[model samples]
Target: MFKLSSTVSQAPISINDSSPAAQASTRLIGFGQTCPQQGCGGASTTLKQLDTRINPDNMCSAGFNASTELCVYSTTSQTACYGDNWQRVGTCARR
Candidate 1:
């Protein structure tokens, strides 16, 4: 068993005039591949990770992060290229 924790400060929500609320609501995506195990839910992606220089795969398991313009869930847990950070350095293959 393992425990992972982090202090993240989320930015305030902004009201946009570009689209409908329903459409924008569907865009606030979070989390990557989640596990039922304890303390294994902090999965995310960052813009730095999306850069090929940092991570080649540059993809997320869940979807995309619009605010940061970074791909989330690109990496998995308990792997070489992944850990608490869970950057998109790793690939999420789906067939």
Candidate 2:
């Protein structure tokens, strides 16, 4: 199973990277995960699995993009991880 990772520790590309509605949605999750300094703007969860967040750092060969902030490939058992947990988005080998 591939794990998702977050770039929260690293400086965001820009202050405007996160949207207001996205931020609010994250607050709704409540206590499930830690929000970045700006709060969880791009976090999300789906029926396929648990309440996993979006990982902005895609450093795997799983061919998924964490920047999208969605549980990429999460619909299937493949489980494309991202965000909060600081896990890599794909099961690919990382350099």
Candidate 3:
């Protein structure tokens, strides 16, 4: 028999600091674990943001490329998407 448990931290994580570039707007979708059948165990965070768009920063052209983030499941070795193009950075795994 197998069981699964998940928990998300209420703390906020800071990303991309010390850069002179403009900060991008980001949003958190949700966090949880995959189905037990998949043997995934641990907590994961999801985030979504608009793809790079043309602005005064990069000129009047969509020269920025959109990227999607992914984090590997510790137990199941499964890949999960944060939101749409948001990538998973880390996992809050419980012993």
Best by TM-score: 2
Predicted candidate 3 versus true structure: per-residue lDDT over 1-95, tens digit per residue: 75548765655555542222334332323454443333455444543222231123333224332232211122233333322222333222221
User: In model 2, where do residues sit more than 4 Å from their true spots?
Assistant: 1-49, 59-61, 66-95
Task: Give the alpha carbon lDDT tens digit for every residue of 1-95 in model 2.
Answer: 75558545675333344433321222111112223333334445432233333323443347555554333222223322234231232222111
The whole-model lDDT of each prediction reads 0.32, 0.31, 0.32
Q: Model 3, poorest ten-residue lDDT window? A: 66-75
Better of 2 and 3 by lDDT: 3
Residue 73 in model 1: shift from native, Å? 8.9
Q: What does candidate 1 score on TM?
A: 0.17
TM-score of each: 0.17, 0.19, 0.18
Candidate 1 lDDT by residue in tens digits, 1-95: 85549755975455443322221112222334344444555554532122122222234444544344323232323321223222122232221
Those runs of model 3 whose alpha carbons end farther than 4 Å from true positions after fitting are 1-12, 16-66, 76-95
Pairs that collide in candidate 2 are 4-81, 4-82, 4-87, 5-86, 5-87, 54-83, 55-82, 55-83, 61-92
- What are the root-mean-square deviations of the candidates from the true structure over C-alphas? 13.0, 16.7, 13.8
Q: Between which residue pairs do clashes occur in model 3?
A: 69-87
Best-to-worst TM-score order: 2, 3, 1
Q: In terms of TM-score, how similar is model 2 to the real structure?
A: 0.19
Alpha carbon lDDT of residue 11, candidate 1? Answer: 55
User: Which portions of model 1 miss their true places by more than 4 Å?
Assistant: 1-36, 40-58, 69-95
